[model samples]
Target: MNKKEYLEKLESELGQMSYKDVKDIMDDIGEHFDEGVAHGKTEEDIAAGLGSPEELAKSFREGGTVASVLQKKQAPVQNARQKDTTASAIFVILFNLFVAIPLWIAIVCAIFTVGAIEIGLIAGLVGLVLAIPGFGNFLAAGICLAITIALAVVFVAVLIILVTKYFVIGTGKYISWNKKIWKEGL
Candidate 1:
């Protein structure tokens, strides 16, 4: 059979399919013929090598239906969504690296410094109690100073615990958000 006969046969066999499918199939087959002719092969030889149009139509119907064509059509959209996801991932990573990480470290160091201050206050209170006897006429003043230091310790301890707890919760939520973006995309 010649190229025209083979394509006409294929088109007739695929008549039940959608217009887009039929057109795409015809275009592909036409290109095959063109390529074969360019390669110095005769139309009859190319049609023989391609097998019967009925068999080609049957294979297309069995395995390459609307689903395959739809997937091809959706490929660009899927690629665009993937690009969006990639951008989100890059933003999250960069933000974590440049802004979030440094800020987190600074807050943690501040917490530690506050903790050290609390320890120092406790030590001062202990020292006041130990030096009370040596204060002599100023023993009342020493007691008042010890009470102030003790109060400061309590205040700092409560502040640090609350801050640390909230910081941890905030960190967990941020990490979860990052995971969600990674898994589900933008």
Candidate 2:
């Protein structure tokens, strides 16, 4: 089939995609077909070289357009809950780094330097209350703080693993596998 005929067939089969998307994909297939034809291949040879129409449609549906793929290595996954959870985890991590750790240090310093355990306890309690959700209408802020702390911790651990993996021989292979799985939507 010619490029236009192949595209029309693709459009009919994949009804949900936009015309522009189909056209762009067809253009890519046409380029490959043209290359094969230049090399003395028949139309049937060109079509087979491009692979099955169903497989091509599946790639477009899951991977998005070539333009979008070039813009970002991996398409964003389509799970709303997953996105929310990732956001929450990241928030918890930041909270731990900036708020929780500093407050804990201050409390410890107060107890040792000034010999004022009561003062330290009071400050620590205040900090804990502020950190806890539903202690006031600041429940949302508390929730955010918790999430930030959690995500920060996870980020740190991942960073450490990445660094160590790259430096170590066998560990680097595992690191490469982790990245591949992440990219492939596993």
Candidate 3:
């Protein structure tokens, strides 16, 4: 089948998944098809080499989360810490397993809380435009309100960037922890 047909079949197979997730998967595979075509391979050739989308989708479903898919895609860092024989290094890995999750939850919660507070501050500023005396000029108030809203949007965008950065850092750290815990036992 053609690229479109193959992806459609895959999407149908992954019917229960989020549309965003399916689109991301299709985008990744589509890039592979593009690369193959660049090298003079046909869509059918690419699809055949990749195997049936149904089976692929089934494997992904069995894997559970998007994080698993992501971890599968990214390669391991070459200079991954050696099986350090130090005492604190081992302690840190074990301590992190239980501790880091709560830390991540707290970070996520803090980001949410900060975003909420910023938006609430914007709302309060808008209210102040009506409540305050000299600052109540309609045109000025409208402009200030728009500026405040824009700032809030920027704040959220920054939060998204920060959270994504945290996710990447956390994923690498977890991989290191897994290696230390499973590969090099105490």
Candidate 4:
């Protein structure tokens, strides 16, 4: 049989093996076929030299060289990938405790302060309008000054609100990223 046919039959014979095991076997066999072809051997000859797929699968099941090699290759790779996530978890916890929480509290205080200032401005404007008769001469100048200052405060409050919104969104995204790293590794 050709390389493809041989591999298909071998894969069928390896049905009881784990996916990784079967894949390793197939890859090794395919490489042998490639090397044999490079040395001017036919696929039939190579497949014959490798022996029947059933016997090969039996050898693999019986802890053959391929099985041993697969075990050796997987052991080191699994260990290498098995990272300790304790550091990342600790960093996130410490940062939230020492930095993020304080920043969030400060942002909340700023928001409340801005809201109060806006309300005070509105009340002052209402009071000024009500006491218009008493301010006769200075009323126009006072009104203009109050309006300008109110506009400035309103602008500042709006900016703070926008900044707080983005800060919250960015913090949420950062927390989500940390959570992903905790689960999946960095």
- By summed lDDT, the worst window of 10 consecutive residues in model 1 runs over 59-68
TM-scores of the candidates are 0.61, 0.31, 0.35, 0.58
* Stretches > 4 Å off in candidate 3: 1-94, 118-136
Clashes (backbone N, CA, C under 3 Å), per candidate, total 0, 13, 0, 0
Query: Which candidate's lDDT is highest?
Result: 1
lDDT order, best first, reads 1, 4, 3, 2
lDDT tens string, model 1, 1-186? 999999999999985899999999999999999999999999999999998999999988787576888998999998988888898899889989999999999999999999999988898889889999999999999989988888899999999999999999999998999988876676
- Candidate order by TM-score, decreasing, is 1, 4, 3, 2
Per-candidate local distance difference test = 0.92, 0.63, 0.77, 0.83
Across 18-85, the per-residue lDDT of candidate 4 in tens digits comes to 99999998999999999999999999999999999889877787876766888999997766555546
Query: Across residues 1-186, which tens digit of lDDT does each residue of candidate 3 receive?
Result: 999999889889987988888889989999999999999999999999999998999977888677787886664532242444354466666677678767878877887787777677667767765554554457776767667776776777687678878877987887686666655545
Mind giving the per-residue lDDT tens digits that candidate 2 earns over 1-186?
665566566667666878788778777777877887799898676776677777777777887676777656544544644675666556555655797568656655643553344345445555755668555787777777666655654565565456445535544564465455444433
In model 4, what are the clashing residue pairs, if there are any?
Answer: none
Worst 10 residues of 3 by lDDT: 76-85
> Candidate 4 versus the native: TM-score?
0.58
Global lDDT of model 1: 0.92
Using TM-score as the measure, the top candidate is: 1
